[model samples]
Target: MEDGFNIGDIVLSKMGRDSGRHYIVVSTDENYVFICDGDYHKVAKPKKKKMKHVEATGSRSEYVAGKIAEEAKTTNTELRRAIAEFEGTENVPVQQDEM
Candidate 1:
């Protein structure tokens, strides 16, 4: 965790095709981490990216972290909610365009 990143931590893709997109860290090992947005990169198949390619958001989902710590399976819905909440965009109200 010295790198300020851990499983379930929120991160931003700093490089590559997914650059600028936010994702959750699903797993990590040495210099690489597996991440997912719960949409394109589902939990079943996360993107393996180098640690340097991501920037930690200093936020984490305890529920996701706990589940992963226990080696439990997580669903896309749960992950999506966690990320939305982390980014403070959960339950966003739909805006109507003025005529």
Candidate 2:
């Protein structure tokens, strides 16, 4: 596993109010990182969390990295989709009610 996290890295919150939640690295500083889930924490309002509070999931989103590298605008839908894809839940069919 990588020792450090970079932009677009997927991480799981190990400690804090958002513990046990998954987030993507939106930005980072020397000791803190900005994370978002595209739901509670949107890209526009990424939560600033200590680096030690999150555990790297060892999975990364190249699509997100490319967008960040290109300085392109990202949306919450995209973030949610990326997370679902990474977790292998994107293809699961939603159950529909029989009316």
List the candidate 2 regions with Cα displacement exceeding 4 Å: 1-3, 92-99
Model 2, 1-99: lDDT tens per residue? Answer: 333889999999999788998899999888898998787888889999989889998899899878988999887777787787878888754332222
RMSD of 1: 6.5
Q: List TM-scores for all candidates, in order.
A: 0.85, 0.86
Off by over 4 Å in 1: 92-99
Error of 2 at 60 (Å): 0.4
Candidate whose TM-score is highest: 2
